[model samples]
Target: MELVKIYECLCDPTRLRLLHVLAQGPVCVCHFQAVLGEPQVKISKHLAYLRARGLVGSERQGNWVIYALPAKPSRELQANLACLQDCARGNPVFKRDLARLKQIEPSCAWVRAGEPQKAPGQCRGG
Candidate 1:
């Protein structure tokens, strides 16, 4: 029952989309806001929910906070995510998001390579 509650958190489309992006690798909060085209407050809210559910992990790097999937998700979680990935593969929005992420390259400070333009504003909480 407790696990079910956590799984339910993943049911939200926005959170699911965020999960898909995080699965690729860690992403900066600003980059996520840019890609989702959502307000920073909304993105922050959803991110907080995802983190509380233990579906994602975050790290702070300088002024940016980057998010990523767990290195070793439980078998059940991993299986479910695999299915979600397949279903999202053909989604136009998902494709566009991926493309945008590629273009941005290293938008998150923790990103390993590629210099990204530092977005203006104080870094928000991850």
Candidate 2:
């Protein structure tokens, strides 16, 4: 990827913040929403922008879509991201975003595949 494109992608504060969170690991839109405290559309818009720039990638997982850093990051991308991570050490908002990401729970969207009635009833001593 061209350095100019990478620099443009990092120009936005929101995108920069997202990069910090995504650097941790792959996550769903719901996770990003909860952590960023932003509307789904807005978060999705940013994700789409990053995906378009080839910085992030996504995959279908059941009913959810997971987004993560590109599997094959260019040397420039890797170095810049690593530097962002290091630079974020002194940024309170970035630190909080990372902390929130760690504490956020995973979505239970997968359970809808089966009815709750399929669950076993209260166990009784045999």
Candidate 3:
């Protein structure tokens, strides 16, 4: 809740990068794992860190936990997030993460015993 706490959370490069990716939209932890290419434990740990700082929130999407920014983050939190996103436009690391996310193969929203999973959003009827 405190601005100083938010700043401390932002001090980590991994956390900063996570914020940049999350700025796009809500994503499952698996997506972050694939994009960041970090182990599940590490990615989940960082996500938990962000969640505890009130910078991120999550919802259960079937079996997956989808992480996103809080619907009503503090004004300062919102502004800082906007700044992080804006500032990342030119950063190579953030750019790479974005590219990887775009390329991510969507998971199957529902497991059909025999059907292959389509890319994210591809589960919807076209």
Candidate 4:
């Protein structure tokens, strides 16, 4: 019912890709667009949907807005996402997006420690 709606919101390929990236750490909106190779408006729309469903969170850092998953997702939600991550890992689109992410910036506190620095031009915002 209500939970199904949440899953539905995440069913889109673009949104699912967004979630996978956010799972790594907080990312700026511009960075997301660059990494995903999608238009800004499209990325924004998907982000709005994710926000409405309470599956993600956002913060403003300087002029950039960064997004991430909840610090403490419910156990069920975490388990569901873990399964989804496995499926997404083998996706070509996800792999390309991940490669792009690595080229954009150095890993930050938002990202997991020990992640490699991204190359330049992968993200647009600071």
Q: Which residue runs of candidate 1 sit more than 4 Å off their true CA positions? A: 106-110, 113-126
Per-candidate Cα lDDT values, in order, are: 0.76, 0.76, 0.77, 0.77
> For model 2, how does the per-residue alpha-carbon lDDT over 1-126 read when each residue is reduced to its tens digit?
398899988998888988998887777787777787788898899999999989998886555577889888999999999999999998989988887766653233232232222334221111
TM-score of each: 0.82, 0.81, 0.80, 0.82
* Overall local distance difference test of candidate 1: 0.76
Candidate 4 residue lDDT tens string, 1-126: 666866896779999899888877778788888898899999999998888887888876555567888889877678778877898877898898888888775534333443334443334634
lDDT (Cα, tens digit) per residue for candidate 3, span 8-124: 888898889888888877777777877887888998999999898789988775556778888898988888888888888889999999888776633433331223334444422
lDDT of 1 at 23: 75
Poorest stretch of ten by lDDT in candidate 1: 117-126
Judged by whole-model lDDT over C-alpha atoms, candidate 4 comes out at 0.77
* Model 4: ten consecutive residues of lowest lDDT: 107-116
True-vs-predicted CA distance for residue 103, candidate 1, Å: 0.8
Pairs clashing in candidate 3? 106-119, 106-120
Off by over 4 Å in 2: 105-126
